[model samples]
Target: MWPTVSPQSRSSPSADGAAILRLEQLTRTFAVGDQFVRALDGVDLQVAAGEYISLMGPSGSGKSTLLNILGLLDRPTSGEYWLAGEQTSTMSDDRLADTRQREIGFVFQFFHLIHRMTAVENVELPMMLAGVPPAERRARAREVLQRMGLEARINHRSSQLSGGERQRVAIARAVVMQPKILLADEPTGNLDSVSGGEVIRIVEALHEEGLTLIVVTHDQALGSRAHRRLLMRDGRIVQDVSG
Candidate 1:
């Protein structure tokens, strides 16, 4: 049986109306030889729906680990994780897999598109997995691609697109499922300033549409754009501030 989280517990207000994610003393550790390396140290964070937050840090500061945990690609070694009002810390792999597919959108520095797949097919990947019909997938993929300014690139293979085009396609795919949260890791790391800003626009548009968004990057300029910023180093947050 699933554990119950009362509706009232889900109603915490953060000026944005509703809390979307909560991390309580979240910690992650890895063993290396005789040493135990702490990747995250007692991190506590709360992200509200429609909020845009950023994580900035030096390399090895646990930003990547935090992003992976949020995206369900990795689990914390210790601490509680509440996502969309559900406790995910104890969920089985199957449950966790389902949660990720249904609730989270992910963008990464590499774009991570299949080089051989056309833009539309990549955009339709999630819908296809959820058993959405081919016709619906096609319609949704086309709709989202058009919104991302990739209508004409629908049939182009990833290799045929420029870096910006590819990342835009990636963003289109990530949000096609209407995920409750979008997690981006260094979304603009590989693009030039112009291309970077374009990606930021796309993310901001999503935020405007009421999605909870978190960006993890090393770029201070990019992090500053978020309403809330967390600065980290050597696996722990050194500072957390909001504007």
Candidate 2:
């Protein structure tokens, strides 16, 4: 469930009256040899449960940095990040890893599949890491792959699949853990239009099912499909549109 916020808080109320994510003056800086570079600068944003958000900007605009931070793969140099109303910036590494595995699902431009593993095996990887029973993992993996329309290719290795098939497999792997939030970074970047459309349809289906979905993409058509569109420049959100 999302957390209820007081009207006094800087974060605006979500349409659903609860916020799943809130960022308070979020900042992330990095060292570049003798100089420091700011990747994210005082970003304040809020996302409601089941909201479909698209982040768009030119390269180097901190889109990936923000996504990385939101996914708990990276830490902010300063500021607070709240997930379901819990501040997480100061969490220990072990706790953060645990939180990420249980709450966040990520899909990337490149399908990061283990080349030697079959599609079902790749989908089972997350559950395996979480120590689920082998029989349960196999059943859940088969279910997800079938839902992704990869039932025929379930036993095929990544090297034997087409680009689209590889991506579907990747998506299956990401969601097999059943996370609350799905963060997709260029999910359709490598596919042709037909393949890309299929991927988008699958992703939108997930959003419709009540997963808070955030996607970073340069494709205008894809971005426009989101419920809210956020434009970023120079590490800050320049525009936010919702309809």
Q: Number of the top candidate by TM-score? A: 2
TM-score of each: 0.92, 0.94
User: What overall lDDT, based on C-alpha atoms, would model 2 receive against the true structure?
Assistant: 0.89
- Model 2 vs. true fold: TM: 0.94
Worst 10 residues of 1 by lDDT: 1-10
lDDT values, one for every candidate:
0.86, 0.89
- What would the per-residue lDDT of candidate 1 be over residues 11-75, giving only the tens digit for each residue? 33253456678889899999999999999998887777767889998889999999999899999
Candidate 1 matches the true fold with a TM-score of 0.92
Q: Give a tens-digit lDDT track for model 2, residues 98-132.
A: 88988899999998999999999999999898999
Full-model lDDT, candidate 1:
0.86
RMSD of candidate 2 to the true fold?
Answer: 4.5
